[model samples]
Target: MFRDEGYDNDTLEDEEEAIMSSAIPSKVDPLDFVYTNIPDTTHILKLDANCKHCKAKKIVSETDGFCCRNGQIELKQPEPIPELMRLWSSMDADSRHFRENIRFFNG
Candidate 1:
């Protein structure tokens, strides 16, 4: 069975207060942040040539040379992941310890 109608009113008020408190922080300044220029979807689309798909710029017909050639495109100069791994492995013990300390403090 439910409680009296008046008891539900008090319970609802308490729940609303708890939700509002959690939503806003104790210390916050509205003026601390400034709004920059609004986003322009049209300009962004123009900047990044839509060669990504078969619709932006077509070299041949409306179905061919849209994205690079066709099929899968190959990288001109592939990144050397192995060299990066070797460099990371060569880090001194003190540097590694400092990185771990920083991570712990941040977390």
Candidate 2:
């Protein structure tokens, strides 16, 4: 069951005031924070390739030419992602994490 109702104008205004008081100080100017064009921060992909299995929307091994996770298809490379990136990626979460290992990715 859901209560489909909205707060009155006064109640909403008081709630906003409370939130503003609890929040961090706001920027003095709209342009105080500067953003610049940057490269991809994290390329979090199970298998970053366009193999037959990947094209079919199925999770696959990152290495060994991006074949299906079934291990029936041929394997190309043992590891495509480097140690740093591999650790950052899910590394077959759909199969490993969902099936056997249970854990959450750290922020």
Candidate 3:
């Protein structure tokens, strides 16, 4: 009876591990705060914002405009809304619910 109980516990643990391993991992988009695209013609701005890449001050000056304080940071374009929504929908219900509750400044 003890051996049977041990075997059952082992089976349950294996099943739990398999379920966790097969579950889809949650994804995080770094550019969730960006609401609008920065126009190609508007490279330099007087506004104060953090660089999406390095989390440093975004702009310097009009004459010596730089993306970051060190002028080495580069921004990445966000995934298209439809593609992001598709991925979001594919996630497990619990993950989707958790992500849906997250609030971003832009929206």
Candidate 4:
């Protein structure tokens, strides 16, 4: 998106006045890390942990009852998605990709 210097004269703006300067520091308010509108984060974490445990328990119960008949059963704990997975999940393959993946959108 390079601008053509022929049509757009940058000299005009420079001749008028300089805009805001970030170099001169001003006392701006710091960000509020403690959000008020959102629910308790600790409670949310606990709920998420409990939900995962419940799902695993349910899977094990079903597997033990149905599949593990020969007494040779190995319950494999699913490998957790690492931090890098966020990049692929959030940026590379976004909501549009997910919507298509889950059949929420027409192919």
By how many angstroms RMSD does model 2 differ from the true structure?
Answer: 19.0
lDDT per residue as tens, model 1, 32-107:
5654555556532224434553445543334454455764664466777874455446577755665567656458
Query: Per-residue lDDT tens digits of candidate 2, residues 17-87?
Result: 99997785665655545544455587765744455543444345545543556445654656665743544
- Runs of candidate 4 with Cα error greater than 4 angstroms are 1-66, 83-93, 101-107
Question: Candidate 4 on 1-107: residue-level lDDT in tens?
Answer: 34566645565565343444444446643554545467655532222211233233233224433444433555687886674356336645564476456544434
User: Candidate 4 has what TM-score?
Assistant: 0.20
Predictions: Cα RMSD each: 16.0, 19.0, 20.9, 16.3
Top model by TM-score, which number? 1
TM-score of each: 0.25, 0.18, 0.22, 0.20
Highest lDDT: give the candidate number: 3
**Residue 54 CA displacement from its true place in model 3, Å:** 37
Clashes of each: 0, 2, 0, 0
- For model 3 the local lDDT of residue 25 reads 50
> Model 1: runs farther than 4 Å from truth?
1-7, 35-107
Q: In model 2, which regions exceed 4 Å deviation?
A: 1-6, 25-107
